[model samples]
Target: MHALREVGVEVPEHTLTAVTGPSGSGKSTFLQCAAGLDRPTAGVVRLGGRVISGMKERGLSRLRRTHIGFVFQSFNLLPALTVQQNVLLPLRLDGRPRDPARARELLARVGLEGREGARPGRLSGGQQQRVAIARALITEPDVVFADEPTGSLDQETGAGIMDLLREAVDRQGATVVLVTHDPSVTARADRVLRLAHGRLVQDSWAGTGTVAAGGVPRDAAAVAGGGPVR
Candidate 1:
């Protein structure tokens, strides 16, 4: 059987979408397929109106550098690079001119203003994540795919990171697709897509405060009032 079966989702621009599911339920597979990191066995994946599922590695690399951003649970910052350099890597890889001012602005926005000269290893977990957030936004990407961004942090720190992501969507007009199993995180999303056994079982939208499961509509309260689909 396919890892993902008959799954289709359309996320509007400038919105935050959360994908949640139990372990081995295809959350990461869906994320990888959607972000062009993994090719879907059969289906199309589009980004910024361009089809990306079938793109070759070189083409996918370019598209990712220029149009997509990612924040991972591990805080994947290059240890050899300073905070500023890490944040500017995407632009450099894209062959775009360096914009130190833009980098500084993003660093400041993520609360790492004066720490730009420091290496990732010199920072706390939360601080490292803040730097990662700065890096993700430095490109002003069309969409950001965050995989369990807050999973490695404590509750308070995770909340802080979530706030920064929420601000990114509200102020910077970014479209974010996040994958997580945290109910609190799901509650903060504008839309939640839940997967089960490689199938999309629920689609909940906070705007309408409703949920559709197994092709049947129901009050969101059926799932703890949008807290979590499970």
Candidate 2:
């Protein structure tokens, strides 16, 4: 059976789109395909102007390092690196000049101003997640794919993380595609895409209060006020 079948989605820039579904419903598969981590058996995946599904692994790696950002549930921090180092990793990998000032600003924005020298093991779960968030935004990526980013935190801490993501869209104009089981996260997103049996079963928009089934837009130009299609 296919992990996803005939599922099409167009996410606008500067908007937060939540992907929610039951266990084993292919939510993660959808995210993986969209983010160029997994190749779909069929169909095309595009990001900005590029067709990601056609790209080779080396090209995908470069694109991920330079234009994409990711935040995962496990924190994914290297134990040996300092908090600052973890946040600057993408820039280093892409051969960009290290901007310590920008890293400091991001750390301060995420409420980790003075903890740059500390390792991830020294911090609490919330603090570590904050560091991960700072890392995700350090590159100023055009798209961020977060899979259950707040799943490991408490209610208050999770809410705080959600606020940081919202600010990324509102302030930095970054598009966020998040996968979560949390109702609070779904409710807060600008749009929600629910999957079942490897298909898009429901699509809802918070801004317009509209819900559509099998959300294959006839004219994506009319979706979300003229953003890039796909």
lDDT values, one for every candidate: 0.80, 0.83
Query: Candidate 2, residues 1-230: lDDT per residue as tens digits?
Result: 66787777777788999999898888888888888988877677889967998899999999998889888767799999999999998899899998889989888876789999999999998788878888888898999999887887788877877888898899989999999999999989988888888777788787555456644443232222211112
Q: How many residue pairs clash in each candidate?
A: 0, 0
Residue 208 in model 2: lDDT: 58
lDDT of 1 by residue, 1-230 (tens): 55777776667888888998888888888887878988876767777778898799999998889888988768789999999999999999889998999999878766678998999999998788878878888888889998888776778767877887898788989899999988889888988999898878888887565456644333332212111111
Give every collision pair in model 2: none
lDDT of 2 at 161: 77
The numbered model that scores best in TM-score is 2
Full-model lDDT, candidate 1: 0.80
Q: Let me know the TM-score candidate 2 reaches against the reference structure.
A: 0.87
**TM-score, every prediction:** 0.84, 0.87
